[model samples]
Target: MPTPELIPADQQLSWRAITDADLDGWEALLRRMAVEDKPDWIEQRADLEEVLAAKKNNPVLDTILGVDGEGTPRSFGRISANAGSNMVHVFGGVDPAWRRRGIGTAIHEWQVARARKRQADAGIPDGFIRAYVEESNPGHRALLESSGATVVRWFTEMTRDLAEDIPEVDLDPEFEIVAFSDDISESMRLAHNEAFQDHWGSEPRDEESWRFTVTHPEFRPDWSLAVIDKSSGEVAAYEISSYDPESKELVGFIEGYTELLGVRRAWRGRRLAPALLAEAMRRFKADGMEHAGLGVDTENPSGALGLYERMGYTPTRRSMAFEKVLS
Candidate 1:
């Protein structure tokens, strides 16, 4: 791949690949960006570290940072493609203070170039690029739309107050809730894959992805709940959760986030989902969490949006996924 274009020589800003030594600078830059772009959001240093660590394991990932003359990161962008997949995901953000200077667009262009090079190396034809934009960010939405990107999918962040009354959802007599354990990891992964087989953009997770998810520092095993069928002793449904201390501290609200929730195909419509959701909410309430949150695809075939609404989860934010063709 050719070298990515840098800021003009006359300008004090320059572009460079992110390095391990830049973690502190990266975290600080992200915090400042969040404060300007999303005052309610919290950017955690450890989360950024975990992501960088994972990227280290991938041979085909690129992260670029736009730095000022003082060496502070003013913009960030990353392009990543899963092995054997023809689509790449690109994410980039510029410091609010640095907006209107074309930094965001430059970062995006660099990411797209890097992704195209990667697709070429992989022999992928008609490769695609995907980017996510929050509904609140008019600038990003305008930029993507004007760049010929179109919305292909939508997601909503939902939150339910644990302090409010939650209705009881009874599981079938044969199903019982249990704590997550390493022994059931394989079973859980298989169940998760099968459960989402019909969902849009669904893909079976590779071993590395599953391991990273299960062992991530923020994954709260105690908050992760699974339902088992007593008859077959098989996994029926699960809710994987994580606790965000930084978000809690910054937002002034303690919340447990359900990262993944799924039920086996045969287990659907058996009230297993509600049962699992209720259990997760109960656990969060017991742990003194003020709220529980989850993201849902608005078009989920399983009527997830309606189900979550019935469970007292209200939409807090909306995000749209956009795709652009990369020949």
Candidate 2:
């Protein structure tokens, strides 16, 4: 556990482990930060509550919240590491009104310390810690750099206006696109693990995490689809989407966000990806969405960026992934 002294005394804030009681304040702070840092992605109270209730997360040990004298959350940090994985994923943010006060630095320091402790306890000798920041956020980039974390990768968020024509890509007769459902969820997870095996920073998501995603409040099963191999009866590809009401309210446009898109190695050349995307876009349009949004790794080995570009998506935002190797 990080000592109380780790919190910057100059900031006049109280730092401690987060609990259910902090949900309202934490979510409010996150919403405010998202509006300032990344308007398209906002974490709501339900999302934070789900994170706190996750079996894999130990908030008392791996999470920290810094609050002002008035008990308003100003900054917070949380870290997660799987039992056998060498990666520690860190997430948190500081209130926009409190920037440049060393509050972000303090939160980051606490996150790194907790990450190291987690790796040490797990006996991971060659692990690494990762955090992401928007390209427009120089303060966050500098903070990571000062901690010796290098920018390992870049990602771009793309949007397609539903008002434009969506191309029709025929799915090969050997495969069929099926609606996403609970019965095929586990199979799709296996297919996803296989599809992204060669992708950067890709790791097999455990059932708990996958379930959390499919059961999220914003998850739109009606908009999600899967490609099934006719002969093998296997899930060959998938496109999962969600509708963020807060984002629509903030951006003033109804957008269907594609959260995950993948095509297995064997099914790559069959145009399944484009077909799934096209079908998803049609559904989004039918449902009165004004735009389609998705994020992709700039260097995706599967040529995803090219695919999205050909599908009429334009880059709107960029983010950097930073990593620090643990000895």
Candidate 3:
């Protein structure tokens, strides 16, 4: 595959492959972009480092950075394609101060080209490139739309105030709620895969990716919970929680994020989801968290939006996933 020029000759910025050394500059640019574009979701240094350290990510081949004349990083883009998957995920951001200079468009073009090449190299016949942007950011949305990407799905960020009355959900007597731990981590992953099997755009996470998620720096096993079927000794439901200190600092409130929540298909009608969520809320309040937050697909087949609303979570922000079919 030919390398697409990340920076146009007419542009003043220079481009290069990103490395671990660029984490500081990259994190700064991302934080600034988040503050202006999506204050509620900010990536921290550790999160950036995780991207660089991912097992399947080759920074030199999959990532690029655009720097100004003075050598200050201003924009970046990266693409990831899971093994045996037909989807290539692209993510990047441009500094607010550098908008309208064609930096974002150039980076996005490069990303799309790289995604297509990756799909072709992998021999994927029916593949697509996916990216996400906050609905409030019209410029970003326009860039994606101009690139032939359309809004494939909408996701809502919901938050519940811990000060409000927490719901008490009753669980079946045959089930028991347990704190997340190493012993049941694999079981939880299996349950998650089975739970989301029918959900749109859902993919089963391999062991490596599942490990990366459960062991993330911000993951809080003590705050996370899992429901077990006492008779069958299987994971029935789970709520994986994480605390983003950076986001807390940015918003000036302690918020516990539910990174993942699911109930196995066989356990769907048992009200295990609401019970697990309510328990998580109780734990968050006990930990002095001001809010409990999670993101849900607006059109989730399981009526997740309605369930969350009934549990006191309201929409705080909306984001759109855009996709372009790979030829």
Best by lDDT: 2
Which prediction has more favorable lDDT, 1 or 3?
A: 3
Candidate 3 error regions (>4 Å): 1-6, 248-252
lDDT of 3 by residue, 125-174 (tens): 88898888888899999999998899989999989999999999998899
**Backbone clashes in model 1:** 0
RMSD of each: 2.2, 1.5, 1.7
lDDT of 2 by residue, 249-319 (tens): 76667899999999888778889889999999999999999999999999887789999999999998899
Q: Provide TM-scores for the models.
A: 0.92, 0.96, 0.95
Q: Model 1 segments beyond 4 Å from truth?
A: 1-10, 39-43, 55-61, 249-252
Residue pairs with backbone overlap in model 3? none
**lDDT tens digits, residues 1-327, model 1?**
115354444445776667778889888887887777674455466556656766433422588777888888888888767777888888778878888877766777777788887888889988999998889889999888877889999999889988889879977799999988998888888888988888888788767678878877778888888899999999999889988776576555788889999999888778988888888888888988999888999988779999999999999889999999987
What's the CA error at residue 285 for candidate 2, in Å? Answer: 0.4
Prediction-by-prediction clash tally: 0, 0, 0
Please give the lDDT score at residue 146 for candidate 2.
94
